[model samples]
Target: MVKGIPVSFGVGIARAVCLSAKETQAVHVDSQPANVEQELKKLHDSIERSTAELNRLHEQVSQEIGAAEAAILDAHLAFLQDPAFAGEMKTQIQEQQLYAVQAVQQVMEHFAAIFESLDDSYMRERAADVRDVGKRMIKNINNPEGDAQEAYTEPFVLVAEDVTPSDTISLPRQLVRAIVAAKGGATSHAAILARSLGIPAVMGAGPELLTQTANGDLVIVDGTSGSIHINPDEETLARYQKQAERERAEMEQLEKLRDLPAQTTDGRRIELVANIGRPEETEAVLAKGAEGVGLFRSEFLFMDREQLPTEEEQFAAYRDAISGMAGKPVIIRTLDVGGDKHLPYLDMPKEENPFLGWRAIRISLDRIDLFKEQLRAILRASAFGKALIMFPMISHVEQIRRAKGLVEEVKQELRQEGIAFDEAIPLGIMIEIPAACLIADALAAEVDFFSIGTNDLVQYTLAVDRMNERLSDLYSYFHPAVLRLIQQVIDASHRNGIWTGMCGEMAADPLAAPLLLGMGLDEFSCNANSLPRVKEQIRRMSYESAQEVAKNALALSTPDEVKTYLASL
Candidate 1:
């Protein structure tokens, strides 16, 4: 009767059949000729194919916090390519005469031990990455021809202690109605992808779920509320089934709003856009009435999969985004990987201040190979549709200049190769850092648009880490300084005849909507589900009136006052 923290909500009862990573028999491969590289090659080939399949699933369906997924593939790629790591395994295989799968499993467990031994919470999280790859490798070897599946699709929910990228990929999207697991954080990979795909899921269910239910039992999953009900009585089941029908009916009604212009009750037009990660997310935008893609995170293309996505792969991804937008503007942000975001292949040392380290444009400018590859891909994809490039974490004028130079260099190469591209793609910068926010006027003059990323903006402005739940309350977007900086960037972008947008959580708030509208933000982007509610609020107030509301908002001393005054308007 031990209760565990419920990270996700939904009650599902399934039979107790836990699939754990298995160990292998010994093989003495060290005694074989040191040149038995063919065996290592075979292992690499299997992992590579598995990686390809995993990446394909990522492209087709959404999982939770998929950013961590790239970390999983990256760790596997690292393990596969690591001469020392693979060398030790092969040596053990020869010396001990072990089974191929078992030998590979043991070596992976060894690396998992290292990550588990780390003291830092962030680094310690890497243990999951190690185990994910390890299990995937064993799965590949054990059932080399196909996934070890007892079912394909049954419209049933999967309840597990945990779920992985491999597990999600192996499931048929149509058959699986929802997913519930007992472990994983809010930003866990399972949760993030579920949000992307619009699947109803709940994770971290713990023992109460496993101990209470059996497999093949009917259940209800309330993703919106994170609740699970098992074997509902006839009346209860009928009620929930009715609720589900109503929800579907309501969603069908919203579909009619897709192409219609977003106008407030007062007749003020508000731009409604989608926050997308890859080109795949563009379809949802078009389906949900998005005028365009407001935030196209390029990080998805750069990370996650084993191989560095080639220019063609990136170009295809970008091309798909542009074509899907159907002439609507796609504002693409160049790689924003840093701090909590990592590429295992990069070999970046553990840093004390990852937030301030080689990240975003800083890393791009320094790593010409990585940066140029991405820029070329975007430029090539630009020919397919309207495309704009935005640089992230631009704290200094010099950084922007350096990044621009690389873009120019890429343009030159395209010219040399006689490849066509949008020669006049609009360039933008994310004014996220305080230094960038304060100096927005200069940055605005140098770029075509400015997007205020309040997630990092609030964190950087307040000197508080948003991930630190202990100080989460202290992470305020309503701080006077933060508002001032937002205004500064907005004012600067407007002064330069460029439009401004805020893609952070602040952009979606009903209270802050009036303030941002007053500050002259030309566009607002947020979660697709939030678009209607925010648009509804905007339609209630005139553009001129929102300006007045924002003016009064600046004088407020507390977050509550800001909220009250805005609502009063």
Candidate 2:
């Protein structure tokens, strides 16, 4: 058995089929023609062909899996359409006199190397996308009329060194039962695509497993535990088969809990919501029985574009999410465009510590015109349904006051223009930075609600850089200090007559459900797929018992102690 990082959550048993990029021979590029314009035209044509193919794949994946998986193709499409990237290729053809294919290969290698060198795992996986696009372009150049689809007849688990977004979308779904990758993490595009497709995946399985197993070997993938058993014994196979059956049955049972209130056995009700990235994902969120949207990331509208999204464009997307929920609260977080998420036109400086640098509300405050446009859109969307505004990475009472001032300014402008809006829209701030947590009481008095963004809160509190693989051991949600801070945030918010919710990865964890419940969190927002399970966990535990668990956990000094105490519950 080999251990790796669990990306998608599921289990499968199947014969393994090894896939390696190295196995595919490099395409030969004919020498550059004397006519540079002809080579440039060839490059443009290849890009167009690759984009058309990607669009087809996007639709195919959306129909088969979900819109989120298909959205991965959107990023690819953006890269293909990026003028700067294409311009670089044109430069290589014009100045270096390289063939169109050779220029593509050279640019692909150059940019892929740069991406792979990044500290962030998500950013690093982008390198795979560069290669994927390059591969498509080369194929089109090599044989424009050739078939793009690669077929495999038999059903098996796919084992690859690295699974790209395009690779996942293009794979024969019926023939691939599971995916075991030697590289990637939960946040990688490959993993996101797998989860959207409901395919079990184990990422970062390391290089040894690739060497130990041969093609067609019997492989058992336990994605929930991030373990892969190669050529398991008969007894092991039987156990895994039973385990898979149990998992299937449990998922079916969990679906029955969808409509039920996320109430404790003691009759305390908890709000269960979803964190969505795009407006297109609202249907999936609703289908998962989310009562509302806890975090509607507005950055999606701003990303992957050459220019800023217009107020009308923003309104349409936000309106879809708000109206789709049918009066359920939608907490729209304003554009959070720094710290790993960059826009082409933003031209943000290269900060030494982006996470702590000018990001989130900082960017918004600095660019009031941009901030006002989004606020106007949110206010306009609020007229359709329950819409609330939430600021990310807020740290000071003054920042909240300043942001609220802008909200009022926009409201006045809309009122003067006789534009309809939700004048009573609730405003809130994300408790991410430690300074915000410590001063929660002061900040709480200024806002209507508090949503703990534990993903960042934990990292900041524990002084651990989660993107660093070596620091994985230290970057834990179970840390006592982090839990203590969470307790403080919840307690402070409640004291100020405001409810506190968590819209982070921690809220989705079933094991942490009791901890959060005991912390007295008013709302639990997680990924849509995790809603049923988290709600089920809440239903099984009594609020009083959860309180006791929290009380005991707070007394613990170490993460292991808190973890052990929680496990005993």
Candidate 3:
């Protein structure tokens, strides 16, 4: 068995099918100067054809999936139209006397390497797009007729060095049984797509697997265990088959609770919602019986672009999510980029500690124009459905007041322009910083509600960067201090007569459910796939018992002590 990172949670056994990235054709330098004009024409024509193909795929994907996922193609389309990019390639061909295809390959590598070297994970992932576009151009020039469309007649485990966003969107879900990638993390686009589709995936399996495994070999991928078994014996296959059957049965049991309310055995009601990044995910959330969207990551609209998103573009994306939810509350978090999520267009200065530096609300507060654009967009979207705006990384009462002040300014501007909006819309703040938790009472009075972003709250509380793999053991969400802070935030919100919800990784854990529910958390938001299991967990216990467990957990000194106490309940 080979160990790998478990990106998506599931188990699958299938025949392996290895996929290799297209290699650039070798180009020999000309002995004499080639006609520069002829090379330029050929390069221009290839770019046009590539743009047209991308446009066609974009429309098809938008119709089949949603526009949010289709927007991945937009980055490629923009690259094709970029004069600087074209000029660089043209210069390489003309000045270096290299073939058009070689010039494209060289330029793409140069730019892609820069992106890969960035500290931000989001920017690093974009390097894949650079390579993808270059491959498309080279393929277009080499095979102008476009080879026949590829199809899979049977289910197979897909093995690749790395999976790009475009590849994830284009593949037929039914034909791909599972994914084993040599590269990628849990937060990568390929992993996100696999989880959304309920496919088992093991990423970062190492390059050696790609070299050792042959196509058509039987393999078992256990996403839960983060292990792969190659060419298992009959007895081993039978054991895995049984395990897969158990997983299916467990899923069926969870689905039975989908239509039921997320109420305790003693009849205490709690709202269970889903956290989504795009408008398209609302369908899955609704299918899993989510009452509303606890968190809509609005920063996704600004990513993978060279310029800031226009107000109209943001409005349309926001409106699509609001309309899709069909009156269910959609709490959109405004522009939480910084730290691990850096945008290519933003001119943010490098910081020694970016997570604690200029990020989220700090950036928005400094760039009021950017903040105003997002506020205006959310305001316009509110007219269509139940929309609430949330501010992230806010630590002080002054920040909340300042942000609310800007909200008022945008509202008045829209009202003067005669644009209809929901004037009574609720605004909220995320309780992530330690400073915010210590004074939750003061901050609670300023906003309509509070959402605990425990992902950051845990990191900040433990002084461990969650992104740092070396500190993984220290970054425990179940740490006593994190729980104490959560209890404090919830209690503070209740004292102020406002509802509070948790939209973080902790809210999704089944073991953490009892502690949170007992702490009187008004709402719980998690990934759509985890919604049913969480709802089922909520239905199984009495509020009184959960309260006892939470009370005991708070007294524990260590994370292990708290976990042991919670597990016993």
Question: Which numbered prediction scores highest in lDDT against the true structure?
Answer: 2
Consecutive 10-residue window with the lowest summed lDDT within model 2: 20-29
Best by TM-score: 2
Task: Provide the global lDDT of candidate 2 against the true structure.
Answer: 0.84
How does residue 146 of candidate 3 score in lDDT?
A: 63
Q: How accurate is candidate 1 locally (lDDT)?
A: 0.71
Per-residue alpha-carbon lDDT of candidate 3 for residues 193-279, written as tens digits (9 for 90 to 100): 676567889888888778767889998999866788889999999999999899889899998888899999999999999887778
Writing each residue's lDDT as its tens digit, candidate 2 over 362-403 gives 999999999999999999999999999999999888899999
User: Could you tell which candidate, 1 or 3, scores higher by lDDT?
Assistant: 3
Cα deviation of 81, candidate 1, in Å: 4.9
Residue 560 shift from truth in candidate 1, angstroms: 12
- Give the C-alpha lDDT of model 3: 0.83
User: By TM-score, how accurate is candidate 2?
Assistant: 0.89
State candidate 3's TM-score: 0.81
What TM-score does each of the candidates earn? 0.71, 0.89, 0.81
Model 2 regions more than 4 Å off: 22-25, 28-45, 56-75, 87-101, 115-126, 139-154, 172-175, 555-569
Better of 1 and 2 by TM-score: 2
